[model samples]
Target: MEGIEEKLVVSTADVLDYHSILEAVKDCCALFCCLDSQDGYEDKMVDLEVRGAINVVEACAQTESMEKIVFNSSLTAAIWRENICSQKDVDERSWSDQEFCRKKKLWYALAKTLSEQAAWALAMDRTLNMVSINAGLVLGPAVAKKNPLVTMSYLQGAAQMYENGVLAIVDVNFVADVNVRAFEDRSSCGRYFCFDQMVNTEQEAVKLAESLSPLISLPPRYECQGSEVYAERLRNKKLNKLVEGTAC
Candidate 1:
């Protein structure tokens, strides 16, 4: 866990600026592209998520010192709320429908989905070495606070997504481990769905709701009705193999 704190160099610049991103990645052996906008509804979202991705890939493409880039993406980038009901068992192969997100007012989800897609496309076009970690709602301590929605709104939405397996949960530590493993293990290819737990049963969902109580608003306990939370399953076979058969 000893990061090169002394080696760290700070720079204040815009993520969308290709030159600034290029400068940031200078002399880096590996780049972990884990940038996205929490505001899903604005022009800034497109600028930060889509354009920023392009800028980073462009910078990494130009940087000879860079080896591999680990892109931290999200389950939102893979699941659309509309498709959750109709679809069966969404996994790493799934991509949230852009049209669906736009139609339903899921701006943050759309931004993430588009951002990840653009990165994949540009990475392939440029032939850059990269791996994406499509993580669930990650919980952990933070020196830098996440966006405003990281609390109630995110938890509420995640509760709904959990019903249909559109959302899951993971510890920040576990997510970090996945990132490092994916980087060290050269054979790790494509996208890895990283989550510690997918609350697929009604009982489990209810427990989650009860635990988060006043922090998040969920339906009344009686309103839950049944114990069957069957919409889709999130699979990570490759992730298990990478983690020495410790399945999540």
Candidate 2:
């Protein structure tokens, strides 16, 4: 891959620092907000996510050059809780129940849901153009090491997610591609669910557990017939519409 500098201008600024973020967004027509907490800092994840989103959206709103903002969110923001199966389908329009998230101590889901909600609220109020990509567990090379916080947080209610058939995965590269598509495609609006596969089978679940080993582990000599596949209720129709006729 080419060096980042060769392809784009990079800047460093704390999301909490409104002035710095405002300055960095200047002269930029589009912005991608992919912010998250680091390892060992999960306790502050909700505060950071909500405030960071507000700050970033406010910055984008203040800039005359800003035309679009692509926000990165999580499928966990929509998949948790017990009654989800009763719904006809889990799609971009669905949102995780905040009370359920709190009851289950799913801070990551709470954080993403609240932050995305905050962003949408401000963007609509300011009449700013924005789109959100609600992605699944992003798996790619060194994902466990590079995105430990998000990965672990996403798996917090693994058994429930698996039982509900909402456990899903998406390639990091695909997520990145979708973000770019969402920003460039004028027709893309609102939220899009971005997942490549569902971990609804014993085989797939085992594979996922194996991949995150050390961070995650399986029983000794574990084996499965790999034939048990759970029903999948999650949908990505909006994402399909956004990428239709385009290379994705």
Candidate 3:
């Protein structure tokens, strides 16, 4: 892959420093935010993922050049500890319970939940045109190679997420496609679940587990066949309609 500097200007910036972020994208028409931090690190997570998110949104709101902002969020902000079996189906409307995330020590989920929530708040308060892509486990080869073990831990959890049917996975390329569509489509509003497929059944989960074992660290081993995973019922008519004819 070519470096970002090859075609685009690359500048050093910090998510925590609001002024720095404002300087980076304030002149742009569209901004795609994919900010995140270490999984279990509370301090870094809050500083970068949470505060950083606010800075980016505020920057968008402050900028006159901004037209659209597409924020890349995780399904973790939508799933986890919500009693998946209780809900008919999980979608963008469903938000992962914050208290539940804390109880389960799902620090990453908590960060994402708070960050996305803050982004929405900023959007509404500023009347900025913003869209969120609540994507599932983003599967890409070596995308997080800097910390493979940590990344693998996330995938290992994916087995349970898939088995429960409330979790989904999307290819990296498809994620970018969805983000672009969300920004370009004038009517694209709110959040779009950017998943290619939902593992709705026990057999499908098992297949995925085996297939992903090579990359996932200590992938989940399912012994029981759960036939009642409401996660399988997740559907995004909005995203489907958005990509009906496009490259996505």
Worst 10 residues of 2 by lDDT: 35-44
In candidate 1, which residue ranges exceed 4 Å CA deviation?
A: 1-4, 38-44, 142-147, 151-160, 210-215, 218-228, 245-248
Q: Model 3, range 1-248, lDDT digits (tens) per residue?
A: 46765777876789889999889985799999987554544534644678888989998899999999999888888877757656676777888888877776677777788899999998999999998998876767655555444455345346557666666777789998888788888888888888898776766666555556565333355475666554465777768887974323
For model 3, how many clashes? 2
Worst 10-residue lDDT window, candidate 1: 143-152
The residue pairs found clashing in candidate 2 are none
TM-scores for all candidates: the values are: 0.83, 0.94, 0.83
What ranking emerges by lDDT with the best candidate at the front? 2, 3, 1
Per-residue error for 175 in candidate 1, Å, reads 0.7
For model 2, the superposed segments whose C-alpha errors exceed 4 Å read: 1-7, 40-43, 245-248
Residue-level lDDT tens digits of model 2 in 1-248:
56766877678889999999998999999999987776623546788889999999999999999989999988988887669877768997789999998888889899999999999999999999999999999999997788787689888989888878899999999999999899888777889899999889999999999898878988888878888888898998778877783322
Displacement of residue 14 (Cα, Å) in model 2 is: 0.7
- lDDT leader: 2
Better of 1 and 2 by lDDT: 2
Positional deviation of residue 198's Cα in model 1 after best superposition, in angstroms: 0.9
Q: What lDDT would candidate 3 get against the real structure?
A: 0.75
